[model samples]
Target: MQRMLDGLIKFRQEDFEEHKALFSKLKRRQEPHTLFIACSDSRVMPEMITKSLPGELFVVRNIANIVPPYKEVHQDYVATTSAIEYAVKSLKVENIVVCGHSNCGGCASIYLPDEVLNNLPDTKKWLELAQNVKKRVMVHLEDETDEYQREWLTEQINILEQIKHLLTYPYIKEKYLNKELNIYGFYYMIETGEVFIFNYDTGVFELSN
Candidate 1:
């Protein structure tokens, strides 16, 4: 808490004064160009990774960066879906980027012991939304080695799966079909500070060289 407060003090004294005009303009209203959905991982800073300034990207972060499919169950209007609807339909964001990162505890939790899994009830339920990814990746790669490479590959596949979940919303589907909004899937290699974007045409996540 002291560290965060000290950083705010620095921002107020140095950064804020330098970018006074930028902050002033933002006070009127924000017109961010993209809705950035990413994991709540400390290493994955969306603004730092994208080189975006303030007011450029509206962001929402959640465990595993999962997007639950639209459903009408009781008390179903959750934070993730509500944010998605507002960003796409109301805010009229031009693009939506769902980004996942390496060394994600949420993804790894799936392989954890029962005692550990039982401790994270909320995370467990949220992760089930991406259960299809686990099934597909496991079955298709049954003989494949369970090395670090496989985990990274599965993580990228999960990003695409969540992207599919995003499109399940009616408003998003309509805008996507009309080509009004572009959706992207991204993976961040935290260890190497590299980012890979999923190329829909090639059906692969290629390094953003």
Candidate 2:
């Protein structure tokens, strides 16, 4: 806590002061260009990675960067959907990027035994959103014995799955079909610091130049 407080003090004295004009303008209103959906991992810093300013990107982070499918009657409160609705309908963001990272605990938890997730009932239920990821991976990549390869593939597949779910929203679909909004899937390699972007034409994720 002290470390965070000290960082806050430094931010106020140095970072904030240096970007005072930008922050001042942002203080009144924000018009971010992109909606960045990323993982709740502390190591994944969306702003730092994209070098975006305070008001440039509206972000929503959740476990495994999952985006649940659009449904008229949601059984429970969903912060992700609310943020997506606001970003697309109200904010009118031009782009949406669903980013999944390497070595995601949420992705790994999908393969764990029911007993393992028994204590974390909510998390278990939440991760059910990515169950399709597991099903596809098991059927397609059954020969992949390498732990790292399996996890990496699952992370990338999860991003694609989330993107599909994102399109389930009518507003997003309308904008997307009209070519007014762009949707992208990103996979970040934490160890290598490389980003792979999904290519619709090739149906594969290639290294971002």
Candidate 3:
């Protein structure tokens, strides 16, 4: 608590003052350019990683960075979907990034047995959105035994899945098809500070260097 308080003090005294003009401009309204959907993991700092300033990225973080399909958006309390909708339909963000990071506990949790998952109750239900992620990854996992590689592959595939989910929205799909909006799938390596971007045409996650 004290550490957070000290950080807040510094932000108000130093960082905020340095960007006071920008903050004043953003005080009334914000017009961020991108909608950044990413994991709720503490290590994945969207602003810091992208070197983005305030009013630059509208961010939504959730477990596994899951995006429920458009058909299910009608369901009650769909926070993630609602954020995506507002960003596209209201904010009119030009780019959407679904980012997943290395060693994500949420992605790994989906591989647990039903009993284990059920123990988590709400988490289990939320992760079921990614059940097919397990099935899709299992096919190519028969011969691979390295835990590290397996982890990254799952995280990368999870990013891809969420990107697909974003397109399920009619507005997003229409804008995407018309080339008015751009959606990206990003997989970050936390330890090495590396990022791989998904290539829609090549069907690969190429390094962002």
Candidate 4:
């Protein structure tokens, strides 16, 4: 906490002062180009990963970076749906990137014991949205190596699933079909610092370099 506070102090004294004009303009309003959604994991820093500066990306971070299929029951769609609608309809972001990373603890949590999952009921339930993702990957790649490759495959599949879920939103569907917004699925490998983009044409993830 002290570190963060001190960093803010330094920003106010130095960085913010140096970029006063930029900050002054940003203080008025923001028009970001992309809506970047990723995990709340400490290791996943979207700005650093994408080499973006302040005000460049509008971001939403949640455990597993999951976006539930739009629903109104019990107002379950409150947070995720609101963010999606605002980003698309109001913010008017041109691109929406659903990024999933390697070695996601949320993905591995499914293998946890009952006791563990019982304590994380909400997380467990949210992750259940990816049940089809887990089933599809496990069955399709049963013969694949059980190492980084498999983990990467799972992460890639999760990103694809989230992208599909994004389109399920009525507003997103309309915008996407009208070519008003573009959706992308990205897999970021933490260890290797590589980003693989899911190619809609070939239905495969290829390193974006």
The most accurate candidate by TM-score is 2
Model 4, TM vs. native: 0.91
How do all models score by TM-score? 0.94, 0.97, 0.96, 0.91
lDDT by residue for model 4 over 1-209, one digit each (tens)? 99999999998999888878888889878888999999888999999999986788999888888888876554554676678778888889999999899889876675568788889888888888888788878877866657565676677778888998898788888989999999998888898999988899999988997
Model 1 Cα displacement at 141 (Å)? 2.4
lDDT of 3 by residue, 1-209 (tens): 99999999999999999999999999989899999999999999999999999999999999999999888437468788889989998999999999999999999998789888878999998998998887778876755677776777788888888888878889999999999999999988899998899998999999997
| Per-residue lDDT over 78-126 for candidate 1, one digit per residue giving the tens place of the 0 to 100 score | 8888888788877899999999999887777666676876787887777
Cα lDDT for residue 145, model 4? 57
Candidate 4 deviant stretches above 4 angstroms:
72-74, 144-147
The alpha-carbon lDDT assigned to residue 130 of candidate 3 equals: 92
lDDT of 2 at 192: 90
Tens-place lDDT digits, model 2, residues 20-89: 9999998879999999999999989999888898999999999999999999878789799999999998
RMSD in order of candidates: 1.6, 1.0, 1.2, 1.9
Task: Identify the leading candidate in terms of lDDT.
Answer: 2
Residue pairs clashing, model 2: none
Q: How accurate is candidate 4 locally (lDDT)?
A: 0.84
| Candidate 3 global TM-score | 0.96
